[model samples]
Target: MGKFIDLTAADGFVFPAYVAEPAGKPKAAVVVLQEIFGVNSHIQQVTDRFAAQGYLAVAPATFHRVKPGVDMGYDEAGMKEGIALKAAVNGLPAPGVLTDIQAAIDHAAKASGGKVGIIGFCWGGFLAWRAACLLKGLSAAVPYYGGGMTAPAEIALQPKCPVLAHFSDRDH
Candidate 1:
């Protein structure tokens, strides 16, 4: 019931993205990065929330790099497949994902008429932080419960925009 759109990365990799537009002229744009679940219902709802806040929101399907349609739930089989995909993605350098994020950023910028922000959950949370670093045009970022970020000292220095990161001590 939401809007679906397409984006082509610098290397000619095309993928689908979920987008939500604000009522009037957008005050800003937000790139909503999904959890490992892909752009499911929850992710779509979250993007809609950003749209309600007067920001054009978009959530790109990051898994398209590994497979054209890779969405998984938290069930046992889904967990297994998600883990496998994560392992395969580890072989790809960070720059590769960064390229995809850049594509999303560009799309949002054009769609929102310039100003942009980013937000993400779980695995996408780490990506939001990375986008804050790699995507220079972003105005802000919010990352929720991204694991393994603290261990990497390099990421601490790369974020170019204001970042608001939230983590649950009990969960992550």
Candidate 2:
């Protein structure tokens, strides 16, 4: 089973991250980013899956900057709340939630003592893409149907590491 732990960012902001350690030694670490929702159960399960694959996994709570303890469902009400929360985070000054993701990556690398990568879905995917381009200490990045990733500005940004993006025809 995985448990929640605290990770401090470069700016001294602390946040909760769901971490799952492998049974044996970890081959690497994978930082899992949440969807539009917060670090909910599904994201935690993804972290567990990574651990099962012999990787250290960490999923940070991306919404903690605006609101603490945000766990919502997939219903319309949840979607509505998530969007508003995302906007609030986006509205924050530069390097808002990105700092939190960096913290997760930093922790994963140290705790696992190996290379680090990142994966994300939906809104998290967009962040993952940006992280690949802007963050440090990542070996690779995968963004599953990253929202707004195809925008002119986002597409123009060069990635610091290799990136594998997954998108469906419905994203357009």
TM-score of 1: 0.90
Best by lDDT: 2
Error of 2 at 109 (Å): 0.4
lDDT of 1 by residue, 23-121 (tens): 889988999988777787888899998889888999998877886667666677876776676566656876776777899999999988978888988
TM-score of 2: 0.97
Best by TM-score: 2
Please write out the lDDT profile of model 2 over residues 1-172, one tens digit for every residue.
7999999999999889999999999999999999878988889899999999999999999999999888888888889999999999989998999999999999999999999999999899999999999999999999999889999999899999999999976632
Residue 136, candidate 1: C-alpha displacement in angstroms: 2.1
Q: What Cα-based lDDT does every candidate model obtain?
A: 0.82, 0.93
Cα misplacement distance, residue 69 of candidate 2 (Å) = 0.9
